[model samples]
Target: MTGPGNPHGGDAGEKSAPAPKKGKRELWKLIPGFAISAFFLWRTIKSIHYDDLRSLHVVQPVWIGVMIAFLLGSYTLRIYRWWFMLRRSGAAGFGVCSRVLLTSFAANNVLPFRIGDFLRVFTYAGDLNASSSTILSTVILERLLDIFTLLAFLVALLLGAAHALPPVVVRGHELNVLHFAEPVLVLCAVGLILLLFGAPLLQRVVESVVRRLPAGARTEKLQRWALLLFDAVLKLSFAGRVLLLVSSIAIWLCEGMIFVSLSRMLAIAVLPRGPWLAVALSNLGFLIPSSPGAIGVYESFCKAAMTSQGAAPGISGIYGILVHVVVFFSVTIAGGVAFLAHRMARGAASRPLRADLADLPVEMPADLPPGISS
Candidate 1:
């Protein structure tokens, strides 16, 4: 639970000093992501034309409100999903969970490497006096649910198409969506199979490795943490798993509606399926390491998806920027506000997070994993 790099654990008053060389190494690592972001950002900007500004003159304002509504709805569902998954962990209620969730997302927007997830788990665990590993398990499961659902969506979109979808052109190269999707689909299938069926084998493998290692505290902790995460999928009840899947689909659909509303507002002509494709591709694009908030990567993916479906390049570029702006500011502002409110409610006595790895259990929860009701 300790703030990332601190192994022995420390409190608010005592902080670990990061090694300069390690810091430099981390900074060096970020350069590639920054370069990638800059390149894609340039590509996105280059795809736009000043003449496209003329489209702004006829923009519809009503869809803006609709987009905001659906965007909020998406976040609401996300909070519910997380809360449902961790409610039994002695964590706080929906309101507290919602604030933590948004604050974490806001952190991800501004900070590199999705550090917000760590913040969410550690901070909430500290507050609840519970096991960070258990909370972490829920997070791992949430991610798997999201990945599975997104891949399922891409497959549905491909199969549901009336005709063959056009290849996406990137830097003069035409790439079929299937080419990208098929491999991902296979990977997800293999991963799901391993998770659902191969946990025992994996546990045996880990045990064998651990048996050969020197006996030590670090070794035991590492084994426990690894197994906890690996077993996350199997921890959930059958019904709880079903609910998570359904909610994930609903969450993405809400986001898709946001894109649909954006297309409507921008008055960009798109195929009936265009908005969904844009939503799927743009979000999946986040997987690529890029700048905070996925800056250039998002716009590039959205523009590509829109353009591939017959929208004008200029209009697609505009739409991409517009949608990103809406999505980014909405979460950032909301998270900022939520973080402030939480701090204010706690008063001035609140201290920096003190992560105690001792809070992590050596065994998984015996009860139904957080989401499922007994």
Candidate 2:
């Protein structure tokens, strides 16, 4: 609630001062991230032979337009998913939620560590007067649901392509089957088991264990917060579950469509089902800790996936680069515009925060921990 470093009583002496050395260290941290991004950009450029650019001239403007449309649709669906999650938690409508999502996406593209996701939570909580903790809990649940859905889709893809894939892909499928599937299945099973039986189990465990502690106001408050968390978990009801499933499916479908449209634009008639595999694999690659936008990791995975599927190295590299550029620019521009609009609206509609801070609490305790520190 009160930030970890913020001290009690809100006095100047209680506040922590910024260290000059820490600022220098923070600046130094950016060096590696920027270097990683630069290295990837160079790799991507080197992979592109001039001769291949001449060949790519055949890609039509009309197909490119279609690809853009699919990407736009994907962004829209992402907003819709976030909106649905917020609605389940009693937040604002889709319009406000979409703007927040756009700003968040913009931040994620520009900032490191996917901070935009948490930013969306902050923005919505501020705008709607909802508990940031509740909204963030929904966000976490949304992500877990998305992962489960992606795993389901990956498994389905592997099974569908079992006979059609080449030996290497088949072997990859086997590895996925043996290595990834078991853990995923076990996790899903455990989550389900917990969801169904967690309430009574937790109640009994807490009553038996926590009752032994000194009975006081803090203990009562702890119990209250635990119940609130349990209630949040319970809010994942039938309708909420259905919405998560539907939205996850819709979002991935949009993504897959974008890939297919890109392939069409490139006039690659036989996309070989590998691009879908590549999409899933590329997402996994981006999960690794790295610089903002996962520049190197994303391109590397895309190139590897395409090359492994027998695509020309040059073509695959160019395609990956183009896809990244298109998606990045599209989201960033849209998000930036939306963020500016939101900022302008807030500025025009209300006085500066410093003016309002006199009336409102300087340190507004959050229902949950602050996310990403803005």
Question: Whole-model Cα lDDT per candidate?
Answer: 0.75, 0.63
Q: What residue pairs clash in candidate 2, if any at all? A: none
Q: Cα lDDT for residue 88, model 2?
A: 55
Model 2 clash tally? Answer: 0
Q: Estimate each model's TM-score.
A: 0.80, 0.74
Candidate 1 residue lDDT tens string, 132-225: 6667777777787777777877767876763336877999998876777777778886766565566567667778898899988777766766
Task: Write down the TM-score for model 1.
Answer: 0.80
Predicted structure 2: lDDT: 0.63
Candidate 1 ranges beyond 4 A from true positions: 1-5, 8-18, 57-59, 162-176, 179-226, 352-374
Clashing pairs in 1: none
Task: Please list the Cα RMSD from the true structure of every candidate, rounded to 1 decimal place.
Answer: 5.9, 6.4
